[model samples]
Target: MMAPFSHTATGKKAAMALRSQLAQGAKFLLGLWMAGVIVAMFVIIPQYEGLGDAGRIIIMHVPTAWVTSLAFVVSGVFSALYLFRRRVSDDASAVAAAEVGFLFCILATATGAIFAQIVWGVFWNWDPRETSILVLLLIYAAYFALRSAIDDDNRKRRLGAVYNLFAAVTMPFLLFVAPRLADSSLHPNCAFIQGSQCDGITLELSGARIGLLGDSKLELKSLERQGDLVVADVNVTRPGYQVENHRPSFDLASGKPADRPEFDGEQFMLAVEQVDLATGTARLNIEAPGSGLLGNSRTLLTFFASMIGFTALFVWLYRLRAQLLMGEEWLAQRERTYGFPS
Candidate 1:
């Protein structure tokens, strides 16, 4: 009987050791994969059409934003499980995921600020997207603060889970719906997708076709060919401001917007999409800085790779943190029950 028990114990130890080794090996591979992603972001990806080298940061920024959302979703799910099952492990997982989400949210904000400074000439404009992300950060910050303030473990977990669920409910609205609903947003969505907020308007040189681009009004005055470029004279008018004629040109050779003029009193520029010199007609659109990013295949692929790497990193971090929290909880419970050091 003693010999059989010894053999069983040895088998259990071997299995645990193998699992530990496999986890370490996976972590090592993840590190290498992320390193390759970083290299590809700079070396393999081409410069974006409007954003240039600065656009490479999207590989980091967008992925972090995605991971932030994903982490929050995981936290919400675990929180719900904890509520239903009343399990300490579920509570630990929820808290771990929320902490990870908060960290990634900060990363997203930092990367976004860097991109904004290069493209929009300001690091901290109160754009809709920026404001929404700020609100999200604050919401999660409050969740952690709530956890720290509570004295009892059971009450803390219960209240924290409830608060986390509410916070998760706000995430989608803050991240996606709100920004798109704001007309004054400088985010560029029309470049890649049709029927977005800033879709270009067609105008004939008759000056009769006036359209709104954000808060500014635009009308085409003239269309003419200048060498290899098709130039359009557009009248831009903002509320409480006089009309101004701005010449936005498109390069016929490259089939791209060339001389884009900034909208009156706004950072967004006017881009000429199409021009018909004979009919004196043109398509004019408002373009925020860094528009048409990810149009390149290499850049798009690298961005996706970065997203996958960040997601895997999040999973690893979440599991490690959850285990640590579980151990801490176990020790605390032991001390409480025994009235002595765990």
Candidate 2:
């Protein structure tokens, strides 16, 4: 006959094992859904060419926005569950969703900024959409900061739950509802599904249109319609190396010293022009200070800053939830060894 304590232990272990399985299953499904979302964004949607006409912005922007909204919704629900049930699993789920939400928010902001640069002639102008999204990001950022400031688990969980609920309530108003009623702006109010009556635009892409067949002139017109400008009649010259006023040939094509032709740096130049009407002229002066022309190092700084910020966030989350994640793993091991439930 089995002892009563042993029976109770077995039941508890079984319950925990079920919960772990449920969580893993949920995570797996979410991952698969996200993968399908990526395919839709990159492959299925872009085939229309109208979406591609926006230049990858639509894919990045719309999906990130969807993920951001869904993630916060998940976070809020889990927060409420944690508050009521006081379960560490609920808290972990909420925090995980929040982190993913934050990532999507940042991506949405970046893609929006890039689109603004192409369409609005600036990266950020504090338009209704831009300002609201910025505020939303800041609010969630404060949620994380507040969590870090609190040392006690109970306090952190309670405070985070309250903040999450508040943020979730305001999100719809800030992101969707308010944008439509507020003002006339260049930003597209795409969140409202029913009231958006703008005609859907389409772009036709074919082999013949882009000079894969028939005529080069037809291809130029198609390229112009697609917001592309072709460069023609380009003249390039490489500067010559001088030794005591004697000039030596430095081939620009080969990027090396060649004896075929003697070229002088002062007399060498390239005059380039584009044949497309939809494009603007660009002149690159390599000697200009703080110039963003051609190649510049500013983008590298932006990459490193984002990397460090997210790395710090990851370290903070891992340390905060170490015991919970590790404990869940240990419980699973014990269950597998003993059977019945774990």
Off by over 4 Å in 1: 1-22, 49-52, 189-195, 204-208, 264-266, 275-281
Supply candidate 2's per-residue lDDT for 89.
Answer: 74
- Each prediction's number of clashing residue pairs: 0, 1
Q: Considering summed lDDT, which 10 consecutive residues are worst modelled in model 1?
A: 189-198
**Candidate 2 residue-wise lDDT, 259-324, digit = tens:** 211113322111111122334222211110111111213333322333333334343443345456
For model 1 the TM-score comes to 0.87
Q: Lowest summed lDDT over 10 consecutive residues: which window, candidate 2?
A: 285-294
The model with the greatest lDDT is 1
Q: Across residues 72-175, which tens digit of lDDT does each residue of candidate 1 receive?
A: 99999999999999999999999999999999999999998998888888999999999999999999999999999999988999999999999999998897
After TM-score superposition, what is the CA distance of residue 158 in candidate 1 from its true location, in Å? 1.4
lDDT of 2: 0.53
- Name the lDDT of candidate 1: 0.86
